[model samples]
Target: MNLTLSLAINGGTGTTKKRKQLLRDSIVVDDVMSCDGGDHHSRVVRLLQARERMMAKLEADDPRVAAAAPDDGSGGLRLMHLLLSSVAAAESGDAHAAAAALHEVWRRASFRGGDPAQRVAAYFADALASSRLVVRSSSSSPAAASAAPPTRAERFLAYTMFYQASPIYQLAHFTANQAIVEAFESGGRRRLHVVDFDVSYGFQWPSLIQSLSHAAAASTSRSNSHDDGDGDCAEPVSLRITGLGTSPDELRQTEARLARFASGCPNLRFQFEGIVDDGPDSGCIKVDDDATVVVNLVFPAAAQSSMTSSTREEECSALLARIRSLNPSLVFLVEKDGSGSGGNAKSRGRSSSVLPAFTASLRYFAAVFDSLHECLPADSAERLAIERNHLGTEICDAMASFADYNDNYGGGDDDHVAEPTATSWKQMMERAGLERVELSSRTVSQAKLLLKMKSGGCGGVGFRVIMEGEGGRAMSLGWRDRAQLITTTGWRSRRRSINKAFC
Candidate 1:
């Protein structure tokens, strides 16, 4: 979430920032840094007040005053301009101009909080407001930076809300399950072992277990060792998940939940083995030689890295190497897309400035906030929890660190839209000797159905799934016309899969 935290794992582009100033959205899931705690204080409110009166005076003659303005009707374009101008000013380090722009934006943005546009405005206002506080405090004031970081539990809860509210988490889990099933069926392996890198609440496994049971049940003709060789009944398929977690208690609770869920599933043999992650050696994860193996990488990170660009890349590369060693039949890469070129091949190899990259990143989150308006009612408690503890916290960290986000993503034309070295995640996977693979039509259809069902208002109008990369190997879930938000890609170790195919 921290702009300085080096956004990784995600790749795509909506529009060129140079031609239309529409910045690329990079998918980053870094830890949130401590905030100034003053953005919501009386001082920031006072700034908004002064700007309100000034805005009234200036727009008095203009027919497009806030009082008469419809959120997306008469004043939408103006409101958008205000946000863009403010971003441009902030990116250029003109704090005074940016503050003036933000004050006006905050008042108008706060007007129709329920409206999607207004919601986007309000979220951006919070981010820019926090960033302003950082600029003013200029370090020596410990009292000003006393904001508390959101706890692991809060993040987990928020992650759950994210899962329910959108296809973000589901896209990863569902697509990964497809490949896992393929692995199990290809070899007709009786036992399947999944090693999840970070199994926080174990929200990803229930659906998979259900799918496995249904598959096992449907194939009544399949041979079953326990059925006297009659073939009328199918034996329960063995599923053992080796889940990694940061806390033992969380691990226990997760195992219990999965165990209870699996009990209801028929023709299924399920067991969960929890391990205290503590960044253990990848080799430590035990795998039964007879069981097919898969790895789940939902927001993979090699430590909550705060290293230089080269160091971060090295760490990620090494992590991929470790995964390849596991020789997982498949590796699912799912990450939040909140920064970088939406999907421009031309700009995928260039570099970027700190503020420009962060400013451009705003478009992705804006679409997300706006789309949520369609997903849940304004009064929904789950929606509120998501906006506050989850999305809001991410915005704060990303915006607050923008001015200081100095890492060489390489350099090129100002508007050329660099994608962190031919894009970070994809390149690393290739270097790790992982071959890109396509997701199934079933996976694609289900994703579309999910978007339609969740954001049913106006038919989830513009939400779409786009297949990118050579041979269209990756998929991205995006809002409206911009196909940049969450990205999911499937991969397999080149050597392992190749040798297995020949054998």
Candidate 2:
């Protein structure tokens, strides 16, 4: 089975040349980073620092691994799903298949159980560890046989979490919740299912719960106050949210966090479900009966990474096609910003066995942090300090440690962090037939600046503060809590009118 799956990935041809070409064609390295011989020493250093900080935080915060954690992480089904899927996939002898299975495992897993993300992370780490130690023959040189694989697990975990940062989630959820509440108040009754992709830490959806609860309460309050003996009143709003993740622990954590949120807002009711071990499916996002499902999965373009080869394009296409078929009110997608240079597309003069994209991203982020520390003002040093306090200093250090791992493995330096933009996701959503409605950005450069100030003990302000004084809020102040790359035709008018009045 391993041989078969490997063939499936490498193509049936036994020639190394064929495999290399196939990898190059499927995994567009240029999409990851564009190297221009510029001075990246500073950037690389910052990344190392951030990697260290993040790792320390993880070690301190994870419940299973740590003696005590900051939060309970009760609703982490997404994490569980990933773990189950990875184990299943490994057992089944098809790595990709195992990864794919995580979607369903996440969806169906209990909302209050083990964490899927951590498990899957561990699984990948363990797998890589095994791969690194697997010596096929004594004839191989000691260095060749004993070399370690890249820190693929760490990179994957960090990138996945960073892809859907807390702020982005807050922004996106803010917008969608507003729209959803307005729809509900306008005599709209719909069953909403919210499926989050790569719900690694489950940090994104708590704000979503808050938004829904607030919206529901406002609608109820207005209804009670404005009614003048009108028997023909609009129906009360109802919302059912089904959240999907790759881990059971994530699902469970989500449920717990949301439950606390729901307790504060009685008008809104929600049922959160988890699907274990599956990726986003087209069938899941179909909107029926005013059902507006929002998918906030942050993944590198499949075309850019070996983890998601060209064959998986069908999966991406199918998922989008299903969402389009549902014709929901809105769909938002977000992706990491890449350097505009196109060199990432060019194949290196090396072997085809590249480390997974997530692993590469981890190194890249670590580099960003290290770079920021060196370049930013000393005032922003508090950002690193606070991060160290909350997360740890190991965040950046992990990357440096892993750099050796990458060098020892087939992984090369294909890491870079560009200003954040939504271009790639915009294209994908457009192809999926979703219309454009809104776009928001928070670039890595800008984030670095903010973190700099934060490090300086300025307490860090929102992005809008630069223009709106010390009290500036987000441009879309009350929109979704998650940042979004949205495309929806004919709906622009509605948003424009709403913003004009609200602003």
Give the per-residue lDDT of model 2 (tens digit) for 192-280. Answer: 65555445455556555666666666766777788887644444334555555566766686677666766676655666655554554
Global lDDT of each candidate: 0.58, 0.35
> How far off is residue 412 in model 1, in Å?
15
List where candidate 1 sits over 4 angstroms from the true fold. Answer: 1-105, 128-133, 136-158, 218-235, 246-248, 275-283, 302-308, 339-352, 378-381, 400-422, 452-458, 469-472, 497-503
Give each model a TM-score: 0.69, 0.44
Residue 430, candidate 1: alpha-carbon lDDT: 86
What is the lDDT, from 0 to 100, of the residue 166 in candidate 1?
72
